[model samples]
Target: MTLVTDPTAPRIAIVGATGAVGNTLIELIEQRGLRYRDIQLVASARSAGTELSVDGVAYPVHAVEEFDFAGVDLAFFSAGTEASEQWVPRATAAGAVVIDNTIAFRMDPDTPLVVPQVNAHLLDARPRSGVIANPNCSTIPLVRLLDGVERRYGVRQAVVSTYQAASGLGHPGVEELREASRATLDHPEEVYPGKEFSPSLAFNVIPKIDRFLDSGFTLEEQKMLQESRKILGLPHLDVTTTCVRVPVVNGHSEAVWIETQGVVDRAELVELLAALPEVTVHDRRSPHEFPTPATIDDPYRVHVGRVRVNPNNPRAFWLWLVADNLTIGAALNAVQIAEELIARGTL
Candidate 1:
């Protein structure tokens, strides 16, 4: 697909427009003051005939099977893996560059898995297969910081534990959390019963995010290790992860520990991390302040804090990280890739 060099006018379509990530994409478009000649909203049959208003302008949502993709220069897809597998080729064939937010093509060998700030250069290949993938939400914020570290001191091993928000499952996940919360309030001592999340997600944390594999790691956990390596170009990096589903409604947080190749100092590390434009360092010793998922206000930046150098291993360090799973981790990254394509005249 070819995009007009004119920044003011590029035809764009957002698939799964009524979904949480789709809504977040619309919000970011308005917030970033982006201009487009046309913006189309496409979704499933049930969402057809519905209207979604962005920046005071309402765009009618159409079913994907019925929507024409010919004029679309760029398409942002947040639909499930099944839908992506079916429609992405059609969209690309219709001359639309697809930025898919599903696991469908992430490890496709040909399709580039991109987090714009971390690996925007990968998009330079323009998906010889005609599709680019947005990495898993949990992997997005993690890799952004790791990129900086890998560029400087060379990371050798890492461990990550995630506290994923209810919103990770989309609108249904958020609603389920709300229902569970209400039920828990009614019966203070009773465990809330819900199938959407195994065990109750209210007043409790689920140690598992996705289904467990034969290797004992959940799919969500495996994605973190695999996607991190691909994004950082470290095919054999030692990485392990434990993904948990927390009751929070908005942001996803993680605790990360890393061992670099060389000795490092806390002060120097913080200075280097702070210099990354997409990362916000909230570390401070005196006031006992740090970043938490709930305390983050801006949805675009990843918040990092609690920088600690391992006393036993000076080459190792630990930190806390947080980001909006729907925005920066999903929609914003897709949009940024589109913008990067435009900047590099690849769209």
Candidate 2:
């Protein structure tokens, strides 16, 4: 493959180059063979000067302060919300279209919040804000399925309980969980000194993710409700969530209970879910055939299983979903958005 860009390729930049999502972005770009005129790896000051390889070519990671965005056509910002708030405008001002993976701009009226699979049509033109917001990780997988269901059967409400992984907090959260797990197994009484997770996450689950808002729902939970409404184009959609942080090192799962406007058939429901793009529903004859975070075969696709209609209420049903938080929830979705923009000649 040619390392130099062709005339049509865009020059791209990856912010937060040292984070989990950033790493996954680079991997996906290579895996999908995204054409780029040039690629820049950018991170905070501390991570600068380190070199990372994209497609076997080592490029020095640049400090955000030093990275120039003047000619960059597309930028993917996986940095924290604060970083996006601070640096995204600079990138946009310098003529880069930003695909941000943060809560900062998802609800911005000028910036369209997008999950390409669910709402790629929003990318028909560049937004007024010069940025495209990637939805919350938990919201992306949920909306992808809900979009099709809403179109087919009409969804009235959705109740979701997410089993999130430590990786959602990035590399530090994963490191802390593993270290804490080791410490707990060796010394059952002493607590591991943790700055990433409170009360420790060793063999324990935390029902809260992000800060608690005034409505008794955590910020992460609130993101799901609001982001889903935006992505699905349902202003009055009902979605209540309980976001939990589990001990799993990667992959996030959700147990979803949905109530539709009309009766849903079990066999038809399985076929409908299976027909959706990049979705796998494991509903064979075996009782144990269900998608779990640990058992998912494809990290890039949303894995669904345990499809069953409510016995008493024909309008309700339950299902299980597993997605790679780093991939489907963050990097893959961002990459797919870029693909859509490129296809539309908007990038």
Candidate 3:
């Protein structure tokens, strides 16, 4: 394990720089004033030679196959699972700490799947595999907000339904939505096949996300269940999820109902949520104030609202949460893990 003694001089690489999550990583670096001595952009061969601007300077994108990982203190991988499977080991072998934002190694016992706000302590010890996994886009915020509650009241079970954005599928999903909407308005009677969505996502919501497993749960929903348990260290915690892709283009929202093992006061829960870092509370009914996909202002903070106790069960409660799927859900959390590693001198 290596740490950047200078803090500002670590060489950083962004794999899949042309993709939405990778682009957001660059944006967050610039916005948060994260300084790296050298920053390299690597993408697929087809996107090679593309220039991505960072802090007013344009960096030429290199093909992952050709990019040398030497001197790269950390590599942020947002490439798809296939690309990660191919390049992650090579990057790690070249002495770079790989923070992978793919599902390929997330479930692997050797890879520490992390959401910095929740389980950043995992970074105190170096990963034996030289890789850390960024959990699914929906899993990050959900686990972050649930961390304190689980710690305090002991979460017995969680029932979550995600209203995922089209952007969750990447840049192609965004384009597909726009194209499908235009095609639908122009030819309302004809059937338009969406590229990333099963049905057209223009004016509709797809209840399925990722492929359905044999248990009737989509991979995305399973991710929320499995990843949450891993992050929260709740192996026996019962969890169920239904992941839906909505018509929106950026923010991902979740409607979560959590059953606690012990009694929890509503006021105390509100106060508890407000105290959590990177979590905003807007639970109010008179003004109809609550988090919505269209109303998320801070991309970094997980906006939590509409907190209420379940009428049917004394131990159960409901809440709504939304966050930028590209930022907090993916890039920001990935980078934060790297930062934690650096701070702990364990990268």
Candidate 4:
């Protein structure tokens, strides 16, 4: 891993610095000791002048409008779609390569939706559009772990059920979950203003995640299906998913079933997953230990377990996968995009 340290080290800007994903992005930059000549933190007007410290250095968060992107080599947009839609083009027009975390550009034909460990070379190819999009939290880890399998055995179809955390909705959602849990514990009649979730998130699961689409799947489920295909470059792939919101605060977990063109055994699948970089296979059976949210919190690697051949279909198998939603699912993916761009001399 050659680190770029030229005097021209890219001037990077992080949009939505006050939000959950944006905060994690800042932490990753400091934790990894990323070498950048300059760093700019941009947030909405309300968060302006707020100070965020990294490695003992304090940086002030500036209002997005006042932050000039003239020389910024890379800008990460973690703000919502409306913000990304409004500012991403402006930043790109100013000659900055934008890696957006919002859905604003993920499905856009011109923008490459990338998960670095899986389709990083796509980033090296220099997108036709200046902006590159990161897939949704549910889609990122799923695609990363399945990329090799899909390519080697030819995935024909998939069915996924997600156990998403409250943090996926950002700060307010986290607060709602926490308050709801406390209220339930205290035997309160009402927890939130209205139902914070479709059902009581405390000690419960809401079968719906994002808004329902015409196809009867939530927007999040559709994103996982469509984006997974796009990222893998498998247009004809058959995929179905059910996204559910859980009370967990951070990590996202999923139970996935995949059908392949050829017969694949559990041992072979385990070997393939274990060998892949940035993936951890924990398929122990003696004590019944497997990847769980409590075990995978804050980790960068995607954890896989319960690898088993489907009883009904010899060509299909099932597994459990977990990953930190804020990091590998969003911020780290953006960072990897920036690193790839720099390595390929595209930034």
Candidate 5:
């Protein structure tokens, strides 16, 4: 394995710079005060020559196909799966570590699916085909909050229902939802086709997320199950999920129930979560406080609340978790991967 020395900041590249998560990634990179000798933003040909401003400085978005990756030390890819499949290898071959945010390489054994707070050690292991995969937006926060509980008392099964925002589908979905709401208020006609959603998302909640599979689960639900197992290193864990699309603009929330092998005390669980780094526990019910999508927007911390033992199941508990999908879910995880590489002197 080849390693780059310390004190020399790496050259970083962000694919799909104009996209929602891509823009958030750049904001985080600057906010964290990360030191990179050079930063390059790449997008599709249609968005080429676009200028994105960071800290009052403008950077031009280049065409991905024509951008050279020769000197790039790391590439943060937030583009779709097809683009990642086509360009990640090219960047890797040019000696850049690729932290991919799409679903393309997630299930690949050669790629490490990671959430930094939960599995930072995964990055310490040998580089897997020069690529690392970030888990789905909903899955990332779920696993991070549940990891400690799973470690202390083994988790046998889980049931999750996701309240996803319009941002999960990118800018067009957000625009559609916003436009649909406006049109509905003014008049009564479908703003977007029924193909986009079975029911109107404006002032409505759709229980289905992504296309359904033969196994009677939507692709988004399956991703949560499969990715959770992989990240927790429990291949046979029984996980069931129902992913929903809500009218919220940002942040993803989940109501999770888990059955554990041993008893888990509610108070102790609350204390543990509060002490965990990057996790905030808000269990106060007197004032009716809890983790809400509106409150957790743009934050890296995953907030947990409503922790209690299930009334029916003796060894089961219920919890609520929320986080900014674009940050903690995608871009922040990618940035942490790069930070990990630098801290470990692997770059």
Candidate 6:
């Protein structure tokens, strides 16, 4: 966060600097040691006068309207879809490359929807569009493993059910769940009248996330399907998901059923998955070996367990995975994309 005079390193800006993902992005930048000439912290006008520190040096939050993007060589956006739609173009037009964590431009023909683990080759050159889209929280971890399976075993179909955390909605959702849970515990007969999510997320689970589309799938579910195809470069890939909002607080977990084109040996499959970069696999039968959201030791890595190939169908298998939605699913991915861009001199 210190102002450096290195001309080769990009001068960076973080839009949505006050939000949860924005905070996580800041943490990762310090942890990963991404080189930057200087940094700008931007947020809504309401948060403008506040200050946030990066690398222990405090930086004042600038209102998006007042911040100039001209000198910012790299800009990271996590300020929801509407904000990205409104401000991203202005940032890009000012010669800043955007690493966007929104649905705004993921499907744009010009913007590349990226999950660096699977298709980082797309970042070898500057994108034709001034922006790069980060995949959905759940889509990211799923595609990371699916890419490995598809290359070695040839994935014919992948059916996943995501048990997403409250943090997927960011801080407000987490606060609502906590207050509602406390309220429920205090008075079991009273309804909390929570506003963050429909029904309630206290001691309960919702099968739907985002708005329900005409196709009957919620927008969250649809993003998983469409984003996977685009990120994996599989136009017609058969990947289906049921996105559920669980009572947990931060990590996202998925139960995947993948049917491959050929038979797969369980041992080979476990070896294959563990070989993936930054992936941890628990193939042991011991009950304590599997990973849970609270049990994940490394927030930066993808955790997979219960790797069982169907005995009746050797070509089909079941696996469970847990990942920090904030890190692997959002902030870390964006930072990794920036790292790749910097290393490749694409920024």
Q: Which candidate number maximizes lDDT?
A: 6
How does residue 7 of candidate 5 score in lDDT?
Answer: 43
Error of 1 at 52 (Å): 1.0
lDDT agreement of model 2 with the native: 0.92
State each model's CA lDDT, in order. 0.87, 0.92, 0.87, 0.85, 0.85, 0.93
Candidate 4, residue 314: lDDT = 83
On residues 1-347, what C-alpha lDDT tens digit does candidate 4 reach at each position?
11246776888889999999999998888787677878888999999999997666788999997889997888999989999999998899898889999989999999999888887888766677899998999899888877888867889888899999998988878888888888887886764543558577887888998688897888888888789989999898788988889889989999999999998877778888888878888874421558888876437889888888988888999889999899988988888888788778887
lDDT at 347 for candidate 3? 62
Worst-scoring 10-residue span by lDDT in model 3:
1-10
Model 2 RMSD in angstroms: 1.0
Q: TM-score of every model?
A: 0.95, 0.98, 0.96, 0.95, 0.94, 0.98
Q: Write the per-residue lDDT of candidate 3 for residues 130-233, one digit (tens) a residue.
A: 99999998888888878899888989888998899989989999999989999999999988986788789989988998888999888888888889889888
In the range 1-347, model 1's lDDT, one tens digit per residue, is 12225655678899999999999888888877656778899999999999998778778999998889998988999978889999999999998889999988888888899988887888775788788899999999888888888888899988999999999999989999999999999988887778788787987899998789999999988888888888888899888999999999989999999999989888889988888877888874432568888788677899888888999999999999999999878998888888888777687
- Using lDDT as the yardstick, the better of models 1 and 6 is 6
lDDT for model 1, on a 0 to 1 scale? 0.87
**Residue 13 alpha-carbon offset, candidate 3, angstroms:** 0.6
In order of listing, the candidates' clash counts read 1, 0, 0, 0, 0, 0
- lDDT, model 1, position 292: 85
Question: Candidate 5 lDDT (Cα, whole model)?
Answer: 0.85
Error of 3 at 103 (Å): 0.1
Worst 10 residues of 2 by lDDT: 1-10
In model 1, which runs have C-alpha deviations exceeding 4 angstroms?
1-8, 189-191, 284-287
Residue 174 local lDDT, model 1: 91
lDDT of 1 at 157: 88
Clashes by residue pair, model 4: none
